[model samples]
Target chain A: MATSIRFDPIRLPPETEVLRGEVRAFLAEEIAAGGFDPRGGYAAERFDRSFSRKVGAKGWIGMTWPRQYGGHERSFLERYVVTEEMLLAGAPTRGHFVADRQSGPILLRHAPEDIKQDILPRITAGECTFCIGMSEPDSGSDLFAAKTRAEPVDDGWRINGRKVWTSSAHYADYMIGLFRTSAPADDNRRHGLTQFLVDLKAPGITIRPIQFPTGKHDFNEVVFDDLILPADHVLGEVDMAWKQATSELAYERSGPERFLETIEVLIELVRVLGAAPDSRGSEGIGRLVAQLHTLRRMSISVAGMLAAGEEPMLQAAMVKDLGTNWEQALPGLARDLAAFADSSPTNRATFDSVIQNATAVAPKLTIQGGTTEVLRGIIARGLGLR
Target chain B: MAEADTIVVDVATRIFQDLGDPQTVNNAGDDSWRAPLWQALTDSGLTLAWVPETAGGSGGARADGFAVLGLAGAHAVTLPLAETLLGGWLLAESGLEAPQGPIAVAPTRHQDRLTLAQDGTLAGTACQVPFARDCDSLALAAEGADGPVVALVAGHDCAIRPGLNLAGEAKDDVIFDGARPRLIAPAGADRDALMLMGAAARAMQMAGALQTLLDLSVRYAGERKAFGRPIAKFQVIQHDLARLAGETAAAVAAANSAGAAIEASERVDAGLLLDVAAAKIRVGEAAGTGAAIAHQVHGAIGYTKEHILHRFTHRLWSWRDDFGPESVWATRLGESVAAAGADELWPTITAA
Candidate 1:
């Protein structure tokens, strides 16, 4: 057991618990005021600017960044509380989620001073939206295979390529994209790719909606045809984006979002089953709750590790692999457990709609962020199997 | 756990490495290794880790004792170390001193009940009592005339029916009819609390065993060759090992978290129950999944008695059934959650 992974039983501090209460109260007030329907999951359809602004007003976005960069200088655990509470409530956080979760951190870490000063405050205020441009027509999980070129110009670089499955690209003001600044080294295929902060409003950039079967327009294809960017827009060192891209994965892969995506179905299942469910329903609900609780404990442990400045890559991958699979299985289990629920019209209708949405959303839960195979491979590497 | 807590586990691990290596013990195929291992544990005062110093035992922190249990699981030591520590803790709770040798707790099964008669005698039968035949003393939690009472009785005074679990460890049925106790006092805890404690300990052990399974699976995958290459080179074997690692990781997290919560809490509330129940259920589930993958990776070797793998897989299978199986805990946890209603679910979960 020499390679045993450690996920310490890290409990939230008292301050984080206090923050959790405040966030819950804020979400409750918003729900009461009809800011957004709690039933609407935080999909692309739930991108509400006013709700995002309200959340930003609460100083939740960019919570762990430096104060000079408009962050509140909060702990990662505090941000974790806010994020999880929002997800549990199914709040319309899509408008600011990427900026708050990922983009802000990347900018704070890699962007130049002027870019940070200009965009950080706006992001903290929930006025800016971001999209990632890593996945292209040719590259998704194999990020180094990106053919999006950013040839050097006199002033900056001219970008030309297509980025597909870019979530929120249609509405995003900026994109933290990966481009092929040079050819990959023969011995190291992970070389040559570079990260840049591309202004989405620049000329020669086209955003076309990639609608889902339900007519939902979340994914998009962003074509960068001779889009010009200043030299300063290059995030971190050129042709060395691979180094920076991996450092944020532990944070990205192990968040509460990995597991809470389809929680609405479980919650609804409990509601429809009433106070005294039969043995079948009770066992089903218990197993789900137990699994969910275990995942949270593990996720929070990872957050604790992040706060302590230790990168628990193996533990984080384990959490995401288990959490996403648990969430993906929740909708179907809920359907099975609620098979004998009361047939009252309202109960049946509520359960039906929730389960249907959850079922529809299940396939992408494992695919997005990182696919299951990719995550397991990361875990295998951590186990020293490769 | 703090750096200070791991010292206890380190001691246990060293002792086990010296006298209780799984492969060595498996090869011996006799009870010869048991005596020295028990002697080493006793000499180190680990057997009384949970008992207070005033109770004639080592007054270690609860977390330290739990860590030792987890280490015991990792080694798959076929001794009654967990049972003895649990018994000592139960005795200390009632201000009673633990005896010298191994101790087994009674009323281990979920439905089994023992009672303290007004005449100061123990009555009733407890099934699935671990190491009942091997222990020198029996720590019984029984329904007294007034309330719950903790009683310590000599094992030889009771009727013991020897049985074996999946791992061939002693899991016996003990009958106490009019057996007078050496010490009996009102307990601050009930049967459920004891069960929770046992469940948490078993979860930690299962977590430990799961880690070993992962280690064994990974090592075997790397060493065993198929189609002119190490099996680990195959994407499918790598993925299976990864899944095993996931299960192992979950078990460790859940089990350790539950042990921590139990150590931190003052009473057995719903929050504590949720932590303990989740640990048992998740770790038990992990045992099944992890054992299968370990065997799958080893092919026929892991399935044989000669291999050390079965020692762990069998213990994992057996330990899950002790205290209560996953289904029992799941039902109790589900009932508690439903009783709290839908809205309180999130809060209950976050109460940690």
Candidate 2:
């Protein structure tokens, strides 16, 4: 059994807090150049294609990736520097996140040669966007039961079934879906499934945007009604979709983004409170600040683990499970802090909108990667209990 | 501060775990409530871990002794371990070095000047004293012209009027009208350190108690079956448990870091107070959650005194409300963290 993870804190070469300033300058220029509003912060998908391309050109995207993949070959800490800057700036980076962080690396390690050659440069140049198609109606936390079948055809495969919660499908280029290849067996039903890169514009692929509890089209239910795919589009080895999917999840679950999802509002709340604090506001915000710092450290530690070539599934799970709360709690905390005194309708309306749109989604945070119970069970098993 | 502290924590944790299952404690039918565990601690020299090494004590850091007290909390073993270690240390630091056996201190806060004579007299009453009945000696924090002075006296050296809390832990109204006593530390010897040290110790205890209830609730969720399956298999139960574990970890981290920081710091000032306050608030919130969730997980079984879960959960609820509840710290911490030139009310809220 693997032992409990004891992380020694990573000490950075103590740099000036002015690193924040440098990032702000770059983002301010980008925002002005592209006319992005602060209201949406990073959530609006106001993604400037040219701006992202420039950022990538500046050796920011794939900053920590290997030089062989047209990356800068910087350390994970260095990439952290870039990420923190972008987030602090509230720059829209999600469009390039999956491709740069997960799919690009997945291509490097396991994707076939032709597939790697086709996707790596596009991702590095921030020209391509990839959305995950792992969750489905009947099979979300339990993706093994997903009925999305990919029957072998003449040249490639004929896929039929539905995928739910594809976030960027309305605007995305392609989708990476986990498809079942063969009938279930006693040994392992999970083994027959494989990941295939499907073109969003392909025939017989129906993309219906699913309006969520909040009136947002951030998700869609995409159906594959006999959509055909070339044999070359399969990601990694056939019948090894679980491994690839898990790896993608590890990337999504381990990033600084997990904790920073609603941090914009948090900082805004702090800014609104101003430098001087009322007695109640000071203590409430201090606790939140301390909690945020701890989560950031844990998330950074998870990143460090990933950097060292460790899966750290449980550690990552811990970070996501806890990080989700901070995201969900942001609006509520903002409201609570402002409740004691005078608060403008503008901030209240904004906070209400966020709460309406995000809080219900917060519970899904743990469910997205794996359920909290599942993580705890895994942790307990790691601790050697039955 | 030393590597051995980790070893001590490991040892203390193991001993507490071996003894913690309150189920066994309840089933054993031992009502006298003597702790073989406390004796084990005495044997391990944990009792003297915080006592001054100069005053015939094996003094280490305050966290050294407090960590052990935290172990006692985790095990749900109630034997006044913190009270005595803190009390004995107060006594030792008072230049008394007089507590030979298990001695507990009730540090009282009195407004009037304590009339101390060469014959060791302690006069006047101290409000908001904890564990007064359980303590052997009273560590009175007498108000001096400069600051609060700490002194120790026999429990019965003053009147022992009974007082109590919701938890079964005994308390008494401690009165000393010119009753004889011995001086511990001189006035103005960094009572702030003692206060921060206390916060650190209490935070650890509350953190441990939170974990204890977290474990109890999780175990209940796993073993107690409903609808022909373990209730833990449900998504809602899973979510609850996940939230519980997350909060427990936060509390542990806060308390753990605060204890470490208190140990590392040379002085306990506003920053230390803020850290301790933060730890205390988190631990208090964590304890409440643990208590609430343990009951929810246990369903009807938790409400009965017969169940061992109540033993731990009840203690958590009790301790959480004491020592200035979470909101109290919230206001204080809020003011402490406020940028200068802030509201006058902020400072007023933190006047103590």
Which structure among the candidates has the greatest lDDT? 1
Tens digit of per-residue lDDT, candidate 2, span B1-352: 3323787888777766676557777677664446576677777767777677677666767667767866677777766677677766665655666465566444432122354444455666554456777666666555444445677777767887777656676655666876766554574334444555666677778777777777777777778899999887776776666566666666776676676656666655565665577677777777777677668878998888788887777777766644456676666666554454223222221221
| Candidate 1 chain B, poorest ten consecutive residues by summed lDDT | B1-10
Report the lDDT tens digits of candidate 2 across residue range A1-386.
02223332332222423443465577778778764554563352445567667777777777666676678776766676667666655677766776776767766776677777677777778887777788888888777888899988999999999999877787777788889887666888777788888888899898998886656566788999989999988777887676664555666776777766556555545545656667667767767655665565556656666777777676677677777756767767776786664545775566565555456556555565566566766555433333
Residue A28 lDDT in candidate 1: 92
Interface RMSD of each: 0.8, 6.1
Clashing residue pairs in candidate 2 are: A282-B334, A283-B334, B94-B184, B94-B185, B120-B181, B123-B178
Fnat (0 to 1) per candidate: 0.73, 0.27
Task: For each candidate, give its TM-score against the true structure.
Answer: 0.98, 0.79
- List runs of model 1 lying over 4 Å from the truth: A42-45, B1-4, B268-271
Residue B253 displacement in candidate 1 (angstroms) = 0.2
Tens digits of lDDT, candidate 1, A115-215: 99999999998899998888987787787789989999988999999999999888889999989999999989999988899989999899999987677
